[model samples]
Target: MKKVLFGLLLAGLMSTTQAAVAQSGSGPAVSYTETVLAAEIGKEILFRRALDWTENHFSYGPKTGAKSDAAAGTVRVTGTGKVTPVATNGKELTRVIRFDFVFRATDKGYDYSVGSFRVIPDPQKPEETMMLSDYIAQLATEKGNGKTFNDRRVTAQANALASEAAMSFRSFMNTMPAAEENTVGIPATE
Candidate 1:
């Protein structure tokens, strides 16, 4: 009976420790999303604008691509950006960060989510990559001074990039297209 009670206590302590570790290491990823209210905008028009905005916003690299479905009123884009964070050792670590953009259009407005971030340790080897969340978690558990500095820097840089892109997208979406000329009243001549 004593042995059984001791075993139960040990198991409880281990579970508590594991839970604390998990909670401490896990955190929010650097991502951003927004829903813009555009009164009177049709879904088709919004979708077209979304496509145009995506094309103009991100320079298509070999790793970047976009897909648009008019019927579904959605545009999904996978884009990449370069981030150079100075390590604790004062060495600049440059990495390629891949992110996702999803634009969903409605008659009332559109919703956009611009983050599903992953970091490629080596740009040459795209497959060797890790999610930003995992990298941040690892950084959080790392030992030594300035460990959090890198974590903060990486998070800030990624968030900044995402915010900038989102802001630009919002501004572009808010702009009204030029009005078409009224050719019905004027006689056609060549």
Candidate 2:
């Protein structure tokens, strides 16, 4: 009976699930990349606020592609990801999850970024893990009852990615070549 239940649970939980990935360009991204991102309502709002009071940015890395002749060039980016629960509780009441992120970026003919990654869940979230496990287990048995679950999951994912992406960009752009880092401090010992 336990084996039958586990099999049915796995089958149901796997069928309706999808994954998400949030990424950024690394090498020779075009200007439109930021423009495209700024169009997002959440991003625009966050960036506007971030720019107002933050003095952060990314140092410009070496350019990878040829110089643009047509005013501005373009970039193409892609990512593949999978989020899977790594471990299930003895009673299937707890779960440890891992999100494998495989990402790459290109511009014209040059490669920008490529990497694989994962999400390491917080250790203190054992209770949340148990709750999620119960939810997934329920999702398996309850069938269409996951309507609310799906909706909540989608909204949570969207908001999280948008928020994180915006913060990352705010930090990144503040460190670039042209960013002014105003400070008053004694020079550090070398």
- How many clashing pairs in candidate 2? 7
Q: Mind sharing the TM-score for model 1? A: 0.74
Please give, for residues 1-190, the per-residue lDDT of candidate 1 as tens digits: 9999999999999999999856653458788988888646677778888898888765534446679899989999888887776666778888888899899998788899889999897668978889988876666656632543566677778888899778878887777565412333566899
Work out how many backbone clashes candidate 1 has. 0
TM-score of 2: 0.26
* lDDT digits (tens) for residues 96-181 of candidate 2: 33211111112212112222122223446622332232334344444443333432342234334333444454455344332232
The most accurate candidate by lDDT is: 1
Best by TM-score: 1
lDDT over C-alpha atoms for residue 54 of model 1: 86
RMSD of 2: 17.4
Look at candidate 2 and tell me the lDDT of residue 24. 15
Measured on C-alpha atoms, candidate 1 has an lDDT of 0.78
